[model samples]
Target: MTPKLVAGIEPPYYTAVFTSIRPDAPEGYAETASRMRRSVEEIPGYLGHESARTPGGIGITVAYFRDLESLDAWRLHTAHQEAKAYGREHWYDSYSVHIGRVERSYGHERA
Candidate 1:
């Protein structure tokens, strides 16, 4: 799949970097992930996100927000909280989350 890069965002935003290694039997993971993605879009101060996964079951999703408050809102979201619990119990073998402030960002695209 082609990655959907979040464009037009300036510096000083925040990012929640979620990296996970899924188990072989990841039942219900795809549907729940899709639901979470759609739910996040409706949140206030949500900038955008980029995500990808490897055939080896290593996945990464980086979600951007306008500030710490917005990121906190996502963390406190009921659906998100539920998803996290489910992921811990069923889907993932291991996972890590890192929150960071983006001081600067640059990239290149070819036409």
Candidate 2:
């Protein structure tokens, strides 16, 4: 789905990040993660996100944001807060978050 970017005259600023974690996860972790991914897409300023399992089947997801404020809103969201607690309590063995500025991006189209 296309993101609903905030209506502002300023050019968009993006944050690009990828996270990897250990494989000690709860049962149905993959399914739950899929649901989580879909939910993230519903948030405002959520450009898109995708994840894949590593060679060892550890999960990695890259989340996109339209701006720093959008990123912070996602970080502090209530349900997201609960999921984070759950991850710490039962789901994830360990995980990481990386924040960065997206200086440039390009898209391709079929000729």
Candidate 2 TM-score over all chains jointly:
0.71
Give all TM-scores, in the order shown: 0.92, 0.71
**Candidate 2 residue runs with Cα over 4 Å from true position:** 1-12, 16-18, 22-25, 107-111
Per residue, candidate 1 scores C-alpha lDDT tens digits across 1-111 of 576578778989999999999965478877998999899998899999988789898989999999999999999999999999988988888999999999998887778
Specify the poorest-scoring 10-residue window by lDDT in model 1: 1-10
User: What digit string (tens of lDDT, one per residue) describes model 2 on residues 2-86?
Assistant: 4443233233556546565656555766676677777777778877765666766477677778788788888887777877787
Residue 25 displacement in candidate 2 (angstroms): 6.8
Candidate with best lDDT: 1
lDDT measured at residue 44 in model 2 versus the true structure, 0 to 100: 82
Best by TM-score: 1
lDDT of each: 0.90, 0.67
